[model samples]
Target: MNERLLLDHLLVRGPASRADLAKITGLSKPTVSAALAGMEDSGLVHLAGEVLGRPGPVTSLYDVTAGAAHIGAVDIGRDWIRVAVADLRGRFVGRKDGRNAAKNSEDLVSRVRELAQAAAGQAGLPWTSVITAVVGSPGVYDKDADRMIFAPNLPGWEGSGLGDRLRTALGVDVTIENDINLAALGEHAYGAGHGIANFALVSIGTGVGMGIVVNGELYVGARGAAGEVSFLPAPEPVPADDDTLRHGLTESLAAAPGVVRAARAAGLHLDTAKEVFTAAAEGDPAALEVVHAEGRRIGGLIVAVASVLDPELVVLTGGVGHNLALLGDAITSRFAELGPLRPRVVASTLGDSGVLLGAVARALSQAWDHIFDLRQSGVQPRQSGVQYGMSR
Candidate 1:
């Protein structure tokens, strides 16, 4: 109990001397010293440095041994795959990014494995040395079915045994979560949503999705699909087709592809949403019109979210949604036309790293829990061969 308490304090508050730990934890100096000594021997805490030039004897500052264990974070997207290796302190020591030109889900899994190994190698460690890994992808993971669902953007992603393949490919215990949900967590931890108790992250790019944070906690619905807002009906008419049904009305009409489709219809010879946004930035009338229409669609979506969630802020992210400067006016206009409710909206500052950072944060939590569990059971975590989330 003493060691765990001291370690927890160190992890949360950074390095501390014995006297400081004792005073903060309400324990005697001797007790604090004993706990520090025990944790130091177990390779969980270390004397990081010494406070010099003090009025009395030198004070030894102790901290959690951040490099004692490592965790992996993977962000799997339609166009890219990102992997990061982070220490116990949630600091990325190594990272690798690669284009995701996967022809199928199996190829995607293999690509993720390659990137994971490369990232681990950059940190001077083998991939197997990572204790836990969290994978952020486009859809909610169905635990009972052991597959992903509602991820039409990524072809073959909803197939059966997808989770098993990821675990096998990575050779580690993996936790799969919705990428947008992770982005919300990332913003809360390190971006625009920081210090906000309640907010929502709505991503509009290849697909549209929302992640809800209520009372500073991620709120996934009963089926882990709390913020799947893409299925919401749009104000404009939607064609009844297989593609439209697969991606839902709102997504089909508001996402990047929708922006491109609208641009093409407006006589703008743009192939990608990026090109349309670029053209709009360069003062192209046709492109600007398309962007404004897309923004209005997003505005309606935000109004819907605000009616139900009433979040403190809504963070806009993803390839297309991050263009807040271009979309702000139209979004505000549509908000006024829709209703009297006005929700705070901001662009995500974390950019492409939001999901990856959130994955690292979650993996760190899991690593800490697993390490302490082993310690409580009288097993040295460094010597324990059991992987995280696995039965001993």
Candidate 2:
């Protein structure tokens, strides 16, 4: 208990001497000394440096061994796959980003494995050495079904036994989560939503989704589908086609593809949403109109979220949603046209790295828990808890 308490302090506040640890942790100096010695012998803490010109004897500072264990974070998106290896301190030691050209779930699994190995290699460690890994994808992982659901952007990703296959491929403990949810966590941990207790992250890209944070913790609903906002009803008439049914109305009308579709309808001749946004930035009237319409759609979505969540802020992210400068006016106008409720909105500062950073943050927490459990059980830290397991 003393060791864990001291270790937690060190992890949060950097290095501290035995006297300081005792003062902060409210333990006796002798108890702090014993705990630090035990942790040092276990390779979990190390003497960082000594304060030279102190009043009495030299005060030796100790810190958690950040490199004692490593964690892996993966972000799987429609257009890209990002992998990062981070130490116990949540600092990325190695990272790799690659274009995703996967045609099937099998290919995607293989690609993720390759990227994990490559990232681990860059960190001068083997992939097996990673204590835990968190994968951020675009669907709700159904533990009972052992497969992803509500993910239409990735082909063949909803197949049964998908979770097992990913574990087999990655050869480590893995947790699959919604990419947008992870982005919210990223913002809460390191970006725009930092220090805010209640906020929502709405991502408009290849697909539309939201992540909710309440009371400083993520709320994923009863079945982990809390923020699947794509299915919400829209003002625009939605087609009764199979594709529309699969992706839902709000996503079909508000996502990047929808932006491009509106741009083409406005005679902009743009193929991608990026192109449409670029044209709008270059002051094309047609493109601007399309963008404003898209923004209004997003604004409607935000209003719906605020009515229920009443979050302190709503962070807009993803490829199309990040253009808050262009979307702000239309969003505000739509807010006026709608009811009286208007939530604070801003663009995501984390960019494409949000999911990856969130994954790292979660993996670090898991690694710490595993380490503590092993230590309490009198087992070697690296012997168990390295195999595949779903995070609940």
Candidate 3:
């Protein structure tokens, strides 16, 4: 069984020949064969046909059955809910995200349920075929307590049974994490930080947040608030006689509110930063200045982060991350001026779904651990999704 688990890992992580799987798992050819036979019987593994070999019969390769299991990822934000159904191999089967502010916490939960169902339907799965579901919430959390500590965006999120409710409603093991943290994890596992040992994900949007990956592990931090970089005060003091426009910190200056506020000051009355960015992208001079100034705010922080953490990469993501084309030069120039230990600065690779993608990855990781750990603990694996009529 242990050899079988090792063989499973080999097939899932990468396509491998039986010899390679035996070498990696430290098993004999017969042991590998027995494990492969079992996995094949279970529909979890299949041969990739013959690989050309040198002066010998073709060697067969084995790979995972990616469609055998599926995962669900949900992103719950102040103004929207995004849901995606991803196959076992991390291929996006289907997705849906729409901008609709929840009237209250109940409405938010209901909307997420609706979106998850819709996503699964689009993916051609039964209403509940997901093995695990991970959610991206708007605030910090204490996973130990299954409690949200401070999620200002989701009014009734913290100090409640939202996790329990979500798990019950979705009929899957539910895990919730901050969107920015999930974004960082997503990038680490599948995006830009595929092999880096250390990095930071600086998300600039409705709020500014950072996620640190140290020694190839996501740094959850003391109290789970390690990367709330927006709360960091500005190094330079506010000028005594300056306009109110000059905020204390760089993130407030660079973040969405700051940009929209600056645009409004420049004779643009955009209620949301979306309006500001739209006008800015369409060649509005006032909106352009807002983006430029927003760059200055983000630039200083980027330099500060680079100098402090000295990570290998710093990726900017979120709603505002897309505007890097408009603001990249100014921010990069400022960062270079300030740092000797500057890291690579890049925009998001996976677009706005980076966080949701990360959530999916996180859920998959947990499911992976659950597969091994529960057996060791003499506990049966809980069925991840609604088991159709089987459970009922």
Candidate 4:
């Protein structure tokens, strides 16, 4: 208990003297002194010189030694793979980004391993040093089947023994989470949703999905598929046989291909959502019309989410969703027309960093749990805790 208190104080207050720790933690001076002695002897903390301020004799200051151990995080997208290694404090020590050129599950697995190794090496550590790793993936991970489901963007990802392959390659317990879920968690932990108890993140890009946070926790329903909003019905019934419908009905209309389709049908002849947005920015009538249509569709989906969950805030993200300068007003206008209970809709501040940051947050949480368990069980800690960059 004393150890945990001291560590928690140091984590929140940075390096502190024994007197400061005692005062902050409400512990006796001898207790703080004893705890610090044990912690320093265990290599969990180190002297950082003396604390200055108050009038008494200078008191020694100590801080968590950050180089004790590390964790890893990966964001696996259809076009890119990003990997990062962070110390126990959750500060990223090394990072690597690579294109996803793999044609099959085996190739993808190998690529992830390669990227993880590269990140670990850059952190001056071996692969085995990564205590835990979390991977942010594009679909719902069915743990019972150990495969990814609902991942039309990634063919053959389901039932591909990906979980086992990742475990074998990394030699550590690997956690796979839906990318959108990670994004919501990221926003809650670090970005727009910070301190907000209830919020939803709707991501519209190559696909459409949402991550819901209710009362300070992620609401992943049964089968880990609660946020799969792609199947929601839209005004224009996308043909069931349409290839884009593979992801879902709403997705086919609110996502990138849908945007491109709208642009082309409007005589714009655009090839990508980026082009559509660019054209819209230039006041192209066709492109603007398409974007307005998509905003209404996306707004309808958000209304559905609000009517049901009524989150405190709604965050828009992804290649198309983050185009707030172009789509924000349209979405708000449509929402106003549709309902009386509209939450504030905003764009993600983290941009593309949400998924990877969320992964690292989870990894750090897991690693710290392991360390705390070891400490409670009387096991000498490999390394203690520290407050890294970007406070969690």
TM-score of every prediction relative to native? 0.96, 0.96, 0.85, 0.93
**Candidate 4 residue spans exceeding 4 A from truth:** 242-245, 381-392
lDDT of 4 at 109: 87
lDDT of predicted model 4: 0.84
Q: CA lDDT, every prediction?
A: 0.90, 0.90, 0.75, 0.84
lDDT of 1 by residue, 21-75 (tens): 9999999999998888877877888989999998999999999988888899999
lDDT of 2 by residue, 332-376 (tens): 999999998899999999989999989987888888888777677
Worst lDDT run of 10 residues, candidate 2, spans 383-392
Pairs of residues at least 3 apart in sequence or in different chains that clash in candidate 4: none
**Deviation of model 3 at 12, angstroms:** 5.9
**What residue runs in model 3 are displaced by over 4 Å at the alpha carbon?**
1-14, 51-59, 234-252, 278-283, 336-341, 373-392
- Sliding window of 10 residues with minimal summed lDDT for model 1: 383-392
Query: Which residue pairs collide, candidate 3?
Result: none
Q: What would the per-residue lDDT of candidate 4 be over residues 1-392, giving only the tens digit for each residue?
A: 78877887787678888878888888999999998898787677889898578698988999887666678889888888899898767788988999998888888889999999999888888867777889998899988789999898875777667899999988777999999999899898889999999999999988888999999988899889998999888778677886756688888888998899888888887789999999999998888888888888887888999999989999999999999888878778988899697888999999778888888878877876776666676666434333221111
Output the lDDT of residue 352, model 4. 78
Instruction: Quote the RMSD, in angstroms, for model 3.
Output: 4.4
- Candidate 3 lDDT for residue 209: 82
